[model samples]
Target: MKIYDEKHLKNIVLLGAPKAGKTLLAEDMVFEAGIIHRRGTIEGKNTVSDFHDIEQERGNSVFASSMHTEWRDYKINIIDTPGFDDFIGEMIAAVRVADTCVMVINAQHGVEVGTELIWDYIDQFQKPVLFAVNLVDHPRSNFDSALQSLKERFGNAVVQMQYPLNQGESFNAIIDLLKMVMYKFPPEGGKPEKLPIPASEKEKADRLHNELVEKAAENDEKLMEKYFEQGTLDEDEMREGLKLGMIHHEVFPVFVTSAKKNMGTGRMMGFIDNVAPCPAEAKPELSADGQELPIDPSKPAVLFVFKTHLEPNLGRLSFFKVISGEVTTASELVNSQTGAVERIHQLFIVDGKSRNPVDRLVAGDIGATLKLKDTYTNQTLHAKGYDITVQPITFPEPRIRTAVIAFSKNDDEKIGEVLHKIHHEDPTLMVAYSKEIKQLIISGQGELHLAVCKWYLENVYKLHVDFESPRISYRETIRKSANATYRHKKQSGGAGQFGEVHMKVEPYFEGMPEPTEFPVRGKEVIDLEWGGKLVFYNCIVGGVIDARFIPSILKGVMEKMEEGPITGSYVRDVRVMVYDGKMHPVDSNDISFKIAGMMAFKDAFLRCEPQLLEPICDVEIMLPEDVMGEVMGDLQTRRSLIMGMDSKGNYQVIKAKTPLAELDRYSTTLRSLSQGRARFTQTFSEFSSVPFELQQKLSKQLQEVEAV
Candidate 1:
């Protein structure tokens, strides 16, 4: 393989909704470049991208696959990403490394919920974007409607570059607005012949051509003057203006293609080679400290790992982008995060699962290397002594959680080990043991995401598991003040243990006044790890209880707080005052005082009107207008408080605050209710008091559990 310079390397990521034909579009591109003699279909399971077993089984891309094609003088490195929102982490990682984003829109369905969700990431990165209307030859395709939706959703930056002549099953021609020519493709759909625009389509073609010219000239002053002086700009001039417009995200050029039949991929590839912005021309990457890291070959070598895969029987493969300088097989770089020296052993330019060994890769180029220690996704490797770390991609938090159990008790530990390995490959899949819930919890984007993890565990690791709803982490707190007295005495042998504690407990709030009934000699405020605070005070007068014993008493109070007497949940936001206590100088010790204090606190808490606090989450659901009524009714059933509602283009956004317990399996429910036309995000809001009736029921359940 030949090496391309920074300016000649253009990296693009294919993104869109599922069934939008992104994988096929990538296949068509590689075939048009002559990299492959024949194209592969998703059904045939032979496509260069989507080569994974899971993708083939599901007929969808699950992981982002890398491929490169040489078009004209430019080397376009393509990263084909999964369209399902479940694998959004794969898409974000690809977007962070790519210079441009080509959103493949299905002509039959314009701007789907998945498409809108993916657009948020593209807009956030501010990457130059363009549209490729795929499946234009389908009988249900509507190119005009798709183009209109794009313009309405994306605003004036959208400009038309090409349009289909016939547009349905008989689609065979496309009018190029920039070149003012007609591309007539043969029935076989390759190597189109350029001809003059016919009179029947000339008027419509001329109007769109002028619009394209004006949109291009608006980006550069020189191009504008040329267009005004000569009444038109040449092809090269227009290309220059469009490239500048793309670089600044001022324009999003649209092109039509039938990727399934390979009708218009060649023209689109030609345009990408000529007009797309190269990696070097893109905005400079920012360091972790927010400093600009310019793309300069003369600078020290720096590479950023964007994705990693654990190939079956092949060890780990790390995919990276050369951000600055050139990397070769012999170079030794230091991991900025780990500070360990790693020598590059093998480097290759990847095309899906196929890797072509390369001696060197320059800045602005993407490639893969094998067997690097102490490096993974979002880590930066730089030349020794050059301290620079690139800002890592910010992945979204998991929205769904479940407790997983291995089928056999012997595989419990093994399941955890395998899950950690899985989490290493995909960060979005979170696995951890929740001590409060006493269950092994796994969280992810949605049900499908976790289902994929289960599939891997069963098929790849041979560990069968079951998922169950995880127990909620509830908190217990007091709502009033109460007092109790307890005396711990033991006389089993010569030395006896005796201690008495008299304490008052009350609900705690910030900036509350100190207790005036007893003199406050010492106070220790502790911030609970789960949430809230615990305040302890020593109010004994005249050394009624030794100062050293105060800590023992406080420890006992904390022990009771760990397992609240009401519901056996963690207790928070309460203050305790030990006003008086009796101790035997000979038998009194930390243990004696701890027991007395614990008993007294528990006795007082039961009489303090203890309440339960459950976790609440802020949920935002986006759905089509037609299904708003049904979705709203469902939310009401879930005890959701309608915080607000807003309109976003063709969708409705509903914001609600709901108890975490009621949100179990909500992602699956929402998908079913809206027929996959809706998407929602949830975040922890706060912990609030549970209703009296629910609290009574939970307390009764806890009593039953304790009895068992």
Candidate 2:
């Protein structure tokens, strides 16, 4: 493999909704470059992208696969990403390393919810973008509607560079607005014949061409002046202006393609080679110290790992982009994040699962290396003394969670270890042991995301597992003040245990007045790990309870708080006062006082009307306006509190606060309700009190479990 310089290397990520023909487009692109003789279809499961077994089995992309092709004088590294929201982490990683994003829109559906969701990231990253209106030859393709949707959703920056002369079934020609020529492809669809624009289509083509020229000229002052003086800019001048506009995200160029039929890809690749921004021209990355790090092969080597893949038998493959200098085999670089020296044993430019070994990779190039002991996703490696670290990509938070159980009792520990390995590869899938619930919990984007994880465990690791609803991390607190007394006495042959504790318990709130009636002496405020606070006061007059035994009593209170009397949840936001107590000088010990304190606190807690507090989540749903009624109705049944609503294009945004217990498998239900036209994000909100009846029911269930 030949290593290209930063200026000649172009990295583009294919992004769009599911089933937008991205994998097929990728196959067509590599074929057009003459790297392969024949094209492969998605149905054949032999495409250059989507080579993973899981992706081939599902007939959709699950991981972001990398492939490269040399077109003209430029080497283009293509990252094909999955469209499902569950795999959003893959897309985000690809976009972070890509200089440009190629959003492939399915002409049949126009701008879908998936497209809109991806555009949000594109807009945030502010990278130069271009659109490939693919599948234009399908029977249901509607080119005009798709074009209109782009313009309406994306504003006037959308400039049509080409359009199908005849869409759907008979689509074989495209009128190029930039070249002002018609490309008529052969039935087999490899090379195209250049022909003059016919008289009948000249007027419309001229109108679009002029619009493209104006859009391009607006980016550069000199180009705008030239357009005003000469009536129109020349081809080279227009390309220059468009390139400038693209770098600043001021204009987005659109082209038509039927990737399934192998048409128009070569032309698009040509434009990409000529006009798209390279890494040297794209936005410069910032270091951890806020220093600008430009792509330059002469600087010390610095590489950022954006993705990690663990092969079944082979070791880990770390995918990274060289941010500066050149990386060669056997080059030792310091892991900036770990300070450990790692030698690059090998370097390869990958084409799906097949890796082509190369001696060197220059700056701005994306490649993979195997088995770096200390490196993983989002970490940076650089030469000694550089000490530069690239800003890590911030992944989306998990939207759903569930408790995972191993089918066999002995596999529980093994299951956790395997899941941690999986999480190492895919950061979006988080695994942790919840001590409160006594279960191992796994969280991801949605149900399908977790389903894929289970599939991998069963098939790849030979571990069978099942998923169950995760228990909510509720809290316990009191509502009023009450007093109780407990005496612990156990008399044996020697050393009798006798201790009595008199305590008053009350609800604790921020800035509440100190207990005046009890003559508060010393206060200890504890910040609970779960949530809220615990304030304990030593109110004994003349030391009715010894200061030494006071700590033992507090310890007892803490034990009971850990396992709340009402439910087996953490207790928080309450104040306890040990006003008086009795301790026998000979028999009283730590254990005796501890038992007395625990019993007294528990008795006072039950009498003071303990309440159960449930976890709540802030949910934001985006769906088409027509389906809002049904979605809102479903939310009502879950006891959701609708906060507000807003409008974005033809979609409605609904924000609500809902209890976490009621949101199991909600993403699947929303997809069904909206026919796959809806998307949502969930975040933890403040905890709120559960209803009275629900609290009673939960307490009864806990009692039944204990009896069993």
List clashing residue pairs in candidate 2: none
Error of 2 at 49 (Å): 0.8
- Model 1 misses residue 400 by how many Å? 1.1
Candidate 2 segments whose C-alpha is farther than 4 A from its true place: none
Clashes of 1: 0
Top TM-score prediction, candidate number: 2
For candidate 1, the TM-score is 0.98
Off by over 4 Å in 1: none
Candidate 1 C-alpha error for residue 669, in Å: 0.7
TM-score for each model: 0.98, 0.99
**Model 2, position 56: C-alpha lDDT score:** 86
Best-matching candidate per lDDT: 2
**Could you list the CA RMSD of all candidates, in the order they appear?**
1.4, 1.1
C-alpha lDDT of residue 211 in model 1? 88
Question: How do the residues 188-255 of candidate 2 rate in per-residue lDDT, one tens digit apiece?
Answer: 89899999998999999999999998988999999999999999999999999999989999888999
Local accuracy of candidate 1 as per-residue lDDT tens digits, 1-708 = 899999898999999988899999999999999888999998899999989888889888999999999989899999999987989999999999999999999999888888888888888889999899999999999998999888888889999999999989999999999889999999888889999999999999988888888998999998999889988788898899999999999999999999988888988888888889888789889999999887889899999999998888887899999999999999999999989999999999999989999999999999999888878888999998898999998999998999998889999999999888788778888999988878999999998898889888898888999999998999999899999999999998988898999999999999999889988999999999989999999999988789999999999999989988868889999999999989898999889999999999999999999989999999999899889999999999998999999977677899999999999999999999999889999999999999999999999999999999
Quote the lDDT for 424 in model 2: 78
